[model samples]
Target chain A: MTVLLDVRGLNVTIGGKPVCEQLDLTIEANQSWALLGRNGAGKTTLVHQLAGLRPVEAGRIRINGHDLTELSPKARAREIGVLLQHSSRGFGASVFETVLSGRHPHLSTMAWENAEDHAIAKRAIARLGLDALSERSLDTLSGGELRRVELARLLAQETSLCLLDEPMNHLDLAYQASSLDVLYQTYVAPSRAMLMVLHDPNLAYRACDHWLILLGDGHWRAGPRDSVADPALLSLTYGHPIERIDSTHGPVFMPRTSLEGAPDNHDAAD
Target chain B: MPTAQHKRILVLALFAGLVSLWLATSTGGTAIPATEVLTHLLSNDGSTHDEIVDRLRLPRALSAFAVGGLLALAGAFMQVLLRNPLGDPYILGISGGASAAVLGVMLLGLPAFWHTPGALVGALFSTLLVFGLSRGAGDWRSERLLLTGVVIAAGWSALISFVLSISPPVRLPGMLFWLMGDLGDADRPLLPLLLMSLGLAIGLLRARDLNLAARGLTQAASLGVNTARLRLELYFLGALLTAAAVATAGAVGFIGLIVPHMVRRLGGTDHRILLPAAALLGGALLVLADTAARSVISPMQLPVGVLTALLGVPTFLFLLHRRVRT
Candidate 1:
């Protein structure tokens, strides 16, 4: 398999706390990887590092055989698109204008969007079901609608690799499924890959072909889903007892809850 | 590309600006008739109107227009940089720094032209100070930059107060007029006009990146915008524009804060349209305000800054109220 993204000896720290230490990762083409970790496990930091927004303390990141540091942010951005956890919406730009901004990586600073750029943005918007909201101001949208608009913007970016901090945030079940479906269909091509931070184990299990689980204190496990999605490893990573139940559809991982006889009367009343 | 509505608004603003410029030139202290004003302006008939038009009112009007345009453009950039609706040229204390410097010059009994250079120096100093302090060994967040500017502005305000309190009574009126944003003393319009055009051109060229920046730094960076470079350029441009405006018109208020917001409400938020539209509207607004400032009291001209606030406050409130109603 051709490697699309390679990370070697990555050392990242936030507030003097070591988040990622001597970590190495290799993502191959046509692979979708889910990043699972507890809160404060540096998921967003890692995403930022991959996107070239944050500096890696000690590491070499190569995208398609080019050193990430050697490339300018704009050049790196052409190969790797990112969707951050939160974005400011105070500018009051319309959806069309906002999505068109996603084409900045492909165009020069002085060049305005051409017909082709507009077509790409329009197709992305249509694919994400944002055509109805194209002219509406972004501030007027609900949280879910805004998330979809951002996803459309990511799609409009049209990069070879996508780094999504939390793709499922602020989305309903329907949108969650549809967004993942769109991501799967659009990005899981011969030369494309995606790395997403997900909180839901079921969605990760169902959608991702590879997994990278970060256990706190500079330890992590990364491999194919079949090799890394062990229930005990996940339980240790999350500090909870996890149980895998095989349903008719597929395997589902859930937190194991202790079932006692009956609760005390006082506890029950409370 | 601007839509039909945007085009219409632009045409209307241009028309209004032309009319306001004519009115400002014709209705000054010596009320030259419009026909004679135009005739002499077109023909250079050596009439006394020629002297007034060429010497006093024309430079003043152009200076006012350029100053207004610069402030508004700076305000628009600041709003995008800080990602706050309330962002304005004065928010970073550029005006405070200039005011303090100008007040100090006045207190020292310096020549009139010295205040301009002094104000420019002070503005640049304050900007560098805020920029340096906000970038201390960590991430460059807009909130931190804003906070640093606000605090530094407060410091400048205290310094201005100290200078004002010690100034002689003879220089008090001049100091007060400058603080209130007077255009009467604006002798040279060329530098401000040049700076205004340069800012507008640069702003238009980078409008798309600015639009991305308005979404946030991370978003802009992810979209291939060199956010750090963009921020640095904006800061430098915004500071330069503010310095030029302050030097030209003594820290005019309200035009910077309200003009961009007004334009955004009328025309959508595309910076390509928004930047030029704000320039035209801002130039028109100030010319009209200056006209009112000179004519309202006849022999005793009110400071243009006071008139801008008086006119801008009610108009801005009306626009906000209308938006809420809609």
Candidate 2:
């Protein structure tokens, strides 16, 4: 199998604090993995380094035999599609223009859009059910709708690897399923790989073939979903006793206590 | 659908521009008929009507149109580059820098070259200074940039006031007239420079990288935009255009801040369309505004800049309200 993304000794820091330390990850083509962590577990920071938004402080990252540090920004953008956690509300771009901006990596300077770019944007928008809102300002969208728009933009990038930070954030129940479904059907089912930061363990188990869980204090474990989904491993990650509950689909987590100083009985109510 | 409205507006502005040009030439201090002015403009004969229409009215009208267009285009570029509605040509102290340089020259009895070259140098210098100070340890901060520009503007305005207060009576009228900003001094030497700046602005309008750069430094860099280089290029282009306009017509204001807002409101905020549309509409709008300045008081003309403020502020406030309501 072709290795799509390879990271060794990766360390990420922001504002003088180490977010992720001594991390190593490898992803192969056609692989789909969920990056599971609690809040502030450095999932976003790790992926940001992979996307080249923030420089990696102490490690080497290679994508398809090309050293990421040596590649120009345009070249890196041509191969990796990133979906940030929350896009700015001030962009004021229309839905179509926002998606079209993803094609910037492929076009030359002073070049006008050709027919192919427009067709790609149209297909991405259609996949997200945003054809009706093609001309509407992005600022007018609800949170879930905005997430789908961002996904469409990633689709427009047409890269081989996706580095998504919390792809399911701000989505409602139905749209949460929809967002994952679309990501699975579009990117994962084919040959491309996806490394997505996920907050919900149930969503992680349901959608991802592989799981990588980051403990609060920088320790992490990664393997196939069945190998990493045990209650003991999850309890070590979230730092509380976790119980499996019966669900129509399968098993799901029920936390015995809140890690953030909430009362123990409140978990049942939640 | 909205494109149809834009086309209608463009046609209306063009028709208004033609009518105002005729009215400006005819209703000057010595009232000539429109037919005679047109005939004089077309003829090579050194007739009395020909001298008035060609030497006096036409240059002033052209200066007003060009300076107005330049300032508006600069403003539109600044607004997009900084991602702030308040970012105009003057927001970064370009006008204050020019004004201070000119005031220093007029007050200190400098050589003849001081007026034009001083203005351009000052405008370019201040743009670089603002760009330098607003940069963070790694990237540019919008709030800091705006604050630094405001500070520079305040300091320069105070210096200009000091110069004006201490100047001798002999140069006071010239200095004060320059400050008031009339289109009365449109000499032949300035026409080529105005055209050059217009060309530069048109070239900048083709920079597609600017669209990506407007979305914050991090966002821009993630999309393969060379954020640092594009920022410097845009600042250079905007400053060059503004300084050239300031050099020609002496501190025209308010057109830059208002015209781009109107364009963004009508044509959408995409720079591919906003840049060109703002330039044309701004030129036509100012031509008509200058006509009103000259014709409303007849023998005693109000300063063209004053008329622009009087017309622009109210419309801007109305647009603000309308935009808020929608």
Candidate 3:
């Protein structure tokens, strides 16, 4: 396999405290890597750095061997598609208009989106099952519907590496399954890959083939699923006692109750 | 990519703008037939009302249209820059600075020629002041920029009041009339019209990137937009346009504040369709308002600034009602 994204010495700091330090990560095509971390583990920051939305400090990130900082914004956008965590509500543009904006990088100054661009945008919208809502304004959309619109935009963007921050946010159970299926079908090819920030370890384990777990205080572990998904290590990383439950399926993680303020495993999923 | 409906709106807006210019020039204190106004505009031949039509009425009407277009374009830029729907040219205190400078020139007994340059200088100075103070370390966050602009505008307001208080009683009515935004003395139409065209060109060139920017800065950056540079461009472009319009017409209010919103309500919010549509519709609206201001009381004209709201509110409500019905 070919590497799509390469990072070296990536340092993630929030409010002067380091969360991840000297982090080296390599994502290859045909692999879905789940980035697991606690609330303040700088997951969003790391994602922003990789997407080149924010300037990377004390690190080097290269997409397809081109230095992230050196690439023009349009060139870089063709390589990395970013799905932000929270889209501002009250987008005044219509669904088709917002999705069409994904073609911004592909267009030159003073040149408009051609018929091919509109057709591609329409196809992406239809893929996300939003064909009927294309003419409607985005402010009228529900959270789940809006997330679908963003996904459609990402599809229209057609970048090689997709950095998804909370792709499952605001999605229902059915939409979640359908959304991952759409992403996997489209991106898990020989020339494209994805790194998603997910909170649920069970879903991450079942959906992804690789793991990049951020332990607190500038430490992380990145490897294939079999070597990195350890019960004791996860327990240590989460600061709670995690029990590995082997059910009818292969395996899933569960946290043990300490009897004080901690809830049982069943309640933990909520 | 403008859709068919957007094209229709654009065409209608252009027609309305032309018709409005004819209406404005025809209905002033010395009334002439609309056909005669059109004939004079086209033939360029001398007639009894030749001075009134060509020299006085035509230039003033064109000035009103260009100033209105400038304010509307500036308003659209401000909305995108600050990410607020209520963004307008006057909100940045550009007009306040112009007012203070013009008042200073009057009170200081300077040559009358200094008023235009003084207003332009003051407006640009206020723009730079807001630009420098807003980006404290190095970022143009909307909340910070908006707050900084609002505070500076308040400062200009205080200065304007102080100048007003100390002014001689002889110049007070003239200054007050100027502050109310009259088009009576604004007979030079060429510069503002040229600036409007330039503004439209630059605005349309950046329209696609502007659409992405409207979503948010981070999203805009992620989608290959140079958000930082775009913010600077929008801030300065809005300031420049506002400065020119204020210099021409002494802070005409409603055209800038409400025209872009009216356009968005009629057309979609895509800047490709929004920018040109705003310029045309805003030009037409201001032309009609200025005509009404001059013609309603005949020899004695109402303040064009006050007349803008008087005409604009009813038109906006009608548009709103029609939008709901559709």
**Per-residue accuracy of model 3 over A68-162 as CA lDDT, tens digit each:** 99999999999999999988543368899889889989989988889999999999999999999998887789999999999999999999999
Docking class of 2: acceptable
Model 1 per-residue lDDT at A92: 79
Q: What TM-score would candidate 1 get against the native?
A: 0.93
- As for DockQ, the candidate ahead, 2 or 3, is 3
List the candidates' TM-scores in order.
Answer: 0.93, 0.86, 0.92
DockQ versus reference, model 1: 0.70
lDDT of 3 by residue, B1-326 (tens): 67898898899889989999989888876789877887787776677676688888889999999988998999888778766665666766777777778778878899867776787778778878876787677456655765777788789878877888888888777777777788878988888899888988999989988888777889989999998799888867787787678777777875766888877777558888889989998889888888988888888887788887565556545644644453
Which window of 10 residues has the lowest lDDT sum in candidate 2 chain B? B187-196
Instruction: Report the lDDT of model 3 for residue B214.
Output: 79
Candidate 1 local accuracy as lDDT?
0.84
Runs in model 3 deviating more than 4 A are A89-91, A257-270, B106-117, B124-152, B310-326
Which regions of candidate 2 fall more than 4 Å away from where they truly are? A89-91, A189-191, A212-223, A226-248, A258-270, B1-27, B31-42, B128-151, B188-206, B315-326
Report the error of model 1 at residue B316, Å.
7.5
lDDT of 1 at A6: 96
- TM-score, ranked from best to worst: 1, 3, 2
| Clashing residue pairs in candidate 3 (N, C-alpha, C atoms within 3 angstroms) | none
